[model samples]
Target chain A: MERVISKVTFDLAQTSLRQVNHFLHRELNSETPKITLLNPDGAHNLAVGLDATIDVEIMGHTGYYTASMNKQATITIFGNAGTGVAENMMSGRVHVKGFASVSAGASAHGGLLVIDGDASLRCGISLKGADIVVGGSVGSFSAFMAQAGRIVICGNAGDALGDSLYEAVIYIRGQIKSLGADAQIEPMMEADYQTVGELLAQAGLSYQPQDFKRVASARQLYHWNADADQEY
Target chain B: MCGIIGLLIKQPHLRDSLGELTVPMLIGMGERGPDSAGLAVFTQTLADPYRKYSLYSGGKDFPWQDLSQALQTQMSKEAELQPHGNQAVLTTDLPSTTLKPWLKAHYPQLHVLSTGRAIDLYKDAGNPTEVADRYHFKDLKGSHVVAHTRMATESAVTPAHAHPFTAGEDFCLVHNGSLSNPNEIRRKLEPRGIHFETDNDTEAACRFLEWRMREGDDLATALQKGFEALDGFYTFLMGTADKLALVRDAFACKPAVVAETDEYVAIASEFRSLAHLPQVKHAHIYEPAPEEIYVWNV
Candidate 1:
């Protein structure tokens, strides 16, 4: 009753961000189960490069690259993120309870990012082998050039969604502004519905799986065409 | 890279704390731009036949009292000069067409930073904290503010090259990205009686917009022309006597975040600079869309 059980607090306003990051990088065991950060106040590089499976809860807004290159750790942000949140993550989960700036979950090899609010331009740009579920709308150029992964957006998609995509699949439940080069709208199949269902269930969304449209690459840019007179 | 910050006070009571809130925002951006910093504050507009001119001596030992006395004797009007080290604000009941030529002939070393009834400008070549402290930015009271911290990518690290560049009265602009067509814009404007003081690309943008405003185009129209004429990436934050405007280029490569509360609207190149505002956590925060004009009135 005196103190919160199984939790540690690091007030960023009282201490430097480097100390908390150092602890996350070098220190931490079963004795410390959950680490909570207070007054992040748009600080960059918080809880990055963590290989351990610990619970991290950030209290306030964060600057760029929050929880980047994360592995096996479950990190959650209570406020908005600046840019590139959970970028290049290997595994585990990163969730933003609020809106995110550009390039959220960018170029992650493997992980899951669940954003409850909208994401700005270039969300999941150049993504690789990560599962991202956005509850709200995504800005322009979402999932551009994504090589391998799955992005499920529950709200509207902005201009040029999934440009020049490869292998990665996008399921959006709302209107599309336009699609980029070689990114085509395709009919949803049984596997696509299952993928959306699993991702949405994990992201805590209850939307019907049939309400989504699938976008994938046309694969026309995969080979060079010399006889077409430069028109694709 | 550089940083741009703007704050527009929506409530009248919040204007008194404008400087106090903005000083930390400017200092927070020091990491992005350490070479030079500048700010333009738009206060209550004065009546007709009186204008406040922000002047800089470039050094700490300028004889401001002597200049004041000289102006009082020569102009036959009550001229008051508020002196603070190298910076001074000269309030006169004469048009700049008369005062500017006189100052040019009398004191050539003095650089007129801004000439308007509602704007007081401060800029220098130094770190953002040092520059704000040197100019007493925490003491500035205004309805709105436009400020910049420069990294010296397109120009030298001189005070003249610092941002929040002003052209016509009561209008100023700060840019966060470089312009590829500044020389071309300069070539088009120089023949049209628009003067440029530095080779800075942001200066080209500032003058272009002000010239459009002077040619009877409103802020929105001028910005539309700016989009068609200016090339390259940018996130511009502009301030007028009664408004604060923000716009990004088509690519939106340069960053800008806005936080809007009931009392104030804060814009910065990044969220870190805007994190210290009062009630910012509860404010409606979002990134501006590309090629869109957002204007907040004072």
Candidate 2:
């Protein structure tokens, strides 16, 4: 574990922390490495575009898009993350210790994203091939445009749940307001319970699988049925 | 609720002065920073550009040439030269605009607004369009711009303290935060012949910028020094003829957002201000990094 950034300097400190990803991508040849930041201020896009199998721990509250475009590295934030914590994530996992803001896992592709606390609006908007598990309630417009993957909500969900969804699995335990145009409540089966339990355990949440309801898209908004088409 | 805007173009293009772009935004802010308003516009006038300058006009002459002269002379052979065509002509040809008297009656202090032939600033109490119309800023264009509207807290509300404090040939600042150690910096800058008109924290900010520029520091370096020495919470934006810089206080209390694409880079206090622009597709809006300075060349 060679410490890359232990203390801030004139060159490294002044360079935008966002560029740290570019530097890492260009310099580091090893696949599985450990990196740490001594003074992790509100830095956005810290470990973005990382394709290697690595472990990164940011010991402070991060700004927007902390592990965006992550490919194969596991990133853990010790503090709260701003909007779109793991936006467009491809693979690996991103774990947040505190609450996340709007668009928590927006348009994610693959891998798992776990939020330890509450999540804001549009938690999994435009979700694709990714699994997102939240330990608490989610705001309005969650799971909108979800093309694939699984989204498990351990707590309550705000208004407009699964609005305009596209073949994404949603599991919620608590109350849910009006569903989106294509969203519908479905009975939780035996396999759904096990899957929800596994996702909850991965998100570090303590809850029973049967305690929640499973909601998903009916795939009504997937294709444009001209006969029934009005507007998107 | 102050208004802040930053523009950085990769190619050579005319910059919309701080007034033309920010007046509307400040007008939108309403009375958030009604006491004063200021702007810093940057342009690439020379082949290679140096981004800041500190103008010390009212300072008493010392045994040797003042800091401005010595540094200008030292950096003259680099690429660009200081205001050399006519210092007397520039001083005497000061705009006959009514802001001087308006400032005298309204803002009695913080009048360090003289920079080279360019770097003109127009600000006062009232609406942003009113000030823009009064100064005819719509026609004034440059490369980079930064503007601010002021709301008086601890200092007297006046026009002289209005933002866009011009230091030298083409250096200016528009600040949204307060300075914790004004007296300390003032004590050091005053004796070196620096004269201040306003008691506002921004005045000290202008003076501190001028002092750093005199020490041969560029806009970004001066801003880095500003973030280090100037205590208290602040979200200040500065500009030279060819550079734009943003500095945040150590605490990161104030808010700012930066958005960039292949075409342009825009910054503002709120994302809605930038939402109107169509080019902003995937903007990463966030708070400023604590104690960090972000600078861009025009």
Candidate 3:
């Protein structure tokens, strides 16, 4: 038997979130590759911790940690997403067609996160290793203490951008309000341009890579210096 | 974490369903705030010298008619009482200085929730849904509303400690985060004869802002000063006689979202509470920025 169902409509209005998530976790097989969630109604933890390769579509707005700890799946939200949309994902892609609240991809280890609209404050706080692309502006304290990976911002960035940044690099095409301690604007090289171009294409945005500026760690605060007296 | 919600209707017809529409918003945040709830609503402004006072009797079954008779006989004024179980709203043209002291001397157990020409407040130590149903929130009519559901991180779980704290007249504030320097704020205002109510941190902020307004600073300026004076994480939503205001601290630790339409302006700590609103799918939704005072007039 082929045993393949092309599309499944899981209406959250008639069913409980626990049943849906349980089915995704326990009963769903590779044959059930696609599931559409209707009437999400801003519920929390809608489809978290999935290890299968599947397509999940959320019809409406979602609460915090909607697709956190995701693996081998593609989750899409047609409406806005709440805080920490894809936190600590191991692998996969989460696409938010609408705006996102604070900490959009916080502490994610690996994944591709894309936002079509603006992302609020601390968009990628404590990010480990995730490539995030934003089509619109991002709020303050973005990319704070990000240890690895890259961030692509197609629009302006708010205050204290890339604060205490580590290895992660931020490429912004718009104006910068202010930069945080030990984070500075650097000249974009050939590799930087290629990286920005590729990430922008992945995020489905077409822009001139030459117009963007690269922001990265200055490496001054990497280790403590005894000679300096509380100055960066 | 606590939950904060505010709704300010722009159209005159929308005010009729203010509380009916707000009940769902309040209950939607039950996961974040299941301890206690409070709300301050602003209705049509009364004429000069006329005010409405919201009183809570602490879950006691008292004769509200007897209190009305005493108010008429002792103070020699025509006052009307509309009771809701343990709660009542007393309307009169009497001065607060004259009536408050009389009430204090006569019925000491009654807690004065709020007093102003256009405001009526209700709060209790119960679930948000229970509190709403108890006060018949579905029937409330108002131009603007400021509500809070408390989880009590830094205070007790008593009705006195609930939010939507008021000071002076026609102004109320609800806070979603804790304050770090309440004692410092208290040390500055106590000498000026500003009485302290509950030891809750929100009370300090309420008194401080009310004092600044009393000193002739408008709500926006007072909030600018609040940015410098108050230290801690806070997302404050406030309601006045003719306006609704919101602000967040510089750190922006707390969360607040605004959904504005042609008919009304709605604010909540999260989008969940606002998902079921009318025409919300088309509402202009955005999070409030840090250190910005967003004021919408009724």
Per-prediction DockQ comes to 0.67, 0.02, 0.75
What is the C-alpha lDDT profile of model 1 across A65-115, one tens digit per residue? 999999999999999887899999999999999999889999998989999
**Lowest summed-lDDT stretch of 10 residues in model 2 chain B?**
B84-93
Tens-digit lDDT track of model 3 for B86-116: 9899999998988999899999999899999
Deviation from truth (RMSD, Å), model 2:
18.9
RMSD for all candidates, in order, please. Answer: 2.1, 18.9, 1.4
TM-scores for all predictions: 0.97, 0.48, 0.98
- Candidate 1 whole-model C-alpha lDDT, 0 to 1: 0.92
Model 2, B87-129: lDDT tens per residue? 1111222232432353345434323355454454445654555
The alpha-carbon lDDT assigned to residue B125 of candidate 2 equals 52
Query: Sort by DockQ, best first: what order?
Result: 3, 1, 2
Off-target runs (Cα >4 Å) in candidate 1 are A1-5
Which candidate number has the best lDDT?
A: 3
The regions of model 2 sitting more than 4 angstroms off are: A1-232, B11-23, B43-112, B282-286
Q: Is candidate 2 or candidate 3 better by TM-score?
A: 3
> Judged by lDDT relative to the true structure, which candidate is superior, 1 or 2?
1
C-alpha lDDT of residue B49 in model 3: 91
